[model samples]
Target: MQARTVFITGASRGIGAALARGLAADGHRVALAARDGDALVELAAETGGLAVPLDVTDGAALPAAVAAAEAALGPIEVLINNAGVSGSAPLARTDDALWARTLAVNLEAPFRLCRAVVPGMVERGFGRVIFIASNAGLTGYAYTSAYCASKHGVIGLCRALAVELARSGVTVNAICPGFVDTPMAQAAVDTIARTTGRDPAQARQALERLSPQRRLIEPAEVVHAVRSLLPEAARGINGHALALDGGQTLY
Candidate 1:
């Protein structure tokens, strides 16, 4: 693959960090992003990439960040919307504020970021857009109303945007991962303990059963899915919610 600059959100940890490291070694320039400046800086240095620390939910910061990146590197040939909020609550318990916050972080933030950079991608006639979504997006998960809804919205956004930009040579797609071995996933496991008083190992086992593989997914597995989008040949695979859940959704 030709060396291209990639701008990724939520590069501080989890699959985002793995993707950054993987892409950098593949001869691609990566722009590290997250709410934490310190974390972003360390991730960038680790990969010899650029650090553009900012919250994805902030609309005002996006254009400036994109411009700065374009000036420092070239126009972003790849954009990864990986930042998201996981809010778990019963459907009846979900308040308007919780719903709004979920949309802001998981849906609206990526929507705005895509709007900011897609124009340039269309002009350049080359770009790759990947959304790091969740299996909750494809199906319902108990007590995670906000999370499931936000991720479902993300998939909708990707599908529509893919069609809109089909002729522009920019591909938009979402990767839905199931119970990945990340801090976020760990928090979900902790939720099991709190809800039913299960031990840590038992709680983890609950999540493991959600996937047919009966184990938490590795970060590298999800990273590999993101890298698949960078190739020229993968342009045909747009507007899809790819399941990287170890066949969890087969049931």
Candidate 2:
């Protein structure tokens, strides 16, 4: 397979950073984009990925960032729309501000990235678009109305894009990970502990139990799943959601 430029959002840390390193190591030129300029520079230097620090929610900056990556690494053949946020609040308590921000960051941002990149990918006749969704997208999780809505929206976006690009040789898919062991998961654990008066360890363990496998997934595990969807042959894998939760949503 010829090496192609891979542009990923949320590339500063967690699964995003892992994917950046993994793809770069696999001979693809990777471009990292996120809010933290310093982290972007650090990881780009370490993994030989280009750092394009910008907020995914910022629509104005996205085109320029893509242009920069194209100028540096050639046309992007793969786009990992992995940037997302989990803002937790009960449905009754979810305000417009919180809801809007979650949608903007998690759903709207990826949509913008896809629109910007897919045109080029369609022209090139080969591309991969991977969305990092959540198990929350598949089913309802308590106290996550805004987050659930945004993630579900992401799944919808992926399906629609896959159909629109079916014959264009570009694949669009989502990775739905449940309770991955990342800083975000730890924060969720802390929130559960404080809200429910449970011990942090117990709350964390309870989250792990939501999965049929009864454990938090490793970031690298999700990264590997992402790897499978990013290859050129994955065009047939479009509109599918790979659950990285060890069967958490099997029910």
Candidate 3:
């Protein structure tokens, strides 16, 4: 693939950072966005990409961030909405604030980003949008009502944009991964350990067992999926919530 301007949210660490490095290695001019300004600057220096410190939940900041990225790198041809928040709570305990925040970060932010980027892509006759969703979007979990609802909303938005942009040379898709070996996953493990009186390792293993492969997914796997969807060769792969889980949602 030829070098294109790529913008990734949550690019400071974990899957988003991994994707930024992978795409940069593939010769794309990248614009990295996240709340971690220090990490973003470091990664930007390392990858030779622009760092735009952004909090995705701040709706007012989205346009300026996109403009800055476009000014520095170029019109964003690839958008990776990887910034997300996960909250695990039973339906009864899931308060309004958690529900609102989960939806804001995981769903509404992506929608806003897509709105900000897709028009230019349409005019340029090319674009790719990838949502870093979760398997919770595909299947219900015991104590993840808000998380599931947010991810499900993301998939819905992805499909809607994919269809709307189908003829305009842009493709929108969601990559729903199961529990991955990221800081977020580690936090979940820590939470389980704190609440259930299990060792951290045991808590982690419980997550791993969610996938039949019995292991947490590596960030590289998600990077590969995003890379696959970005190229012209994968043009037909639109409007689909591509599951990155190891058959966790196969049923």
The residue-by-residue lDDT of candidate 3 on 57-101, one tens digit each, is: 888999999999999888999999999988888889999999999
Give the TM-score comparing model 2 with the true structure, all chains together: 0.97
lDDT of 1 by residue, 123-193 (tens): 99999999999989999988888889899999999999999999989999999999889999899889889
Cα lDDT over the full model 1: 0.90
Model 3 clash pairs are none
Model 1, position 38: C-alpha lDDT score: 87
Q: RMSD in Å for candidate 1, one decimal?
A: 1.0
lDDT of 3: 0.92
Give candidate 2 misplaced runs (Cα > 4 Å): none
Q: Distance (Å) between predicted and true CA of 129, model 1?
A: 0.7
Q: What is the C-alpha lDDT of each candidate?
A: 0.90, 0.89, 0.92
In model 2, how large is the Cα lDDT of residue 1? 57
- Candidate structures ordered by TM-score, highest first: 3, 1, 2
TM-score of 1: 0.97
Sliding window of 10 residues with minimal summed lDDT for model 2 = 227-236
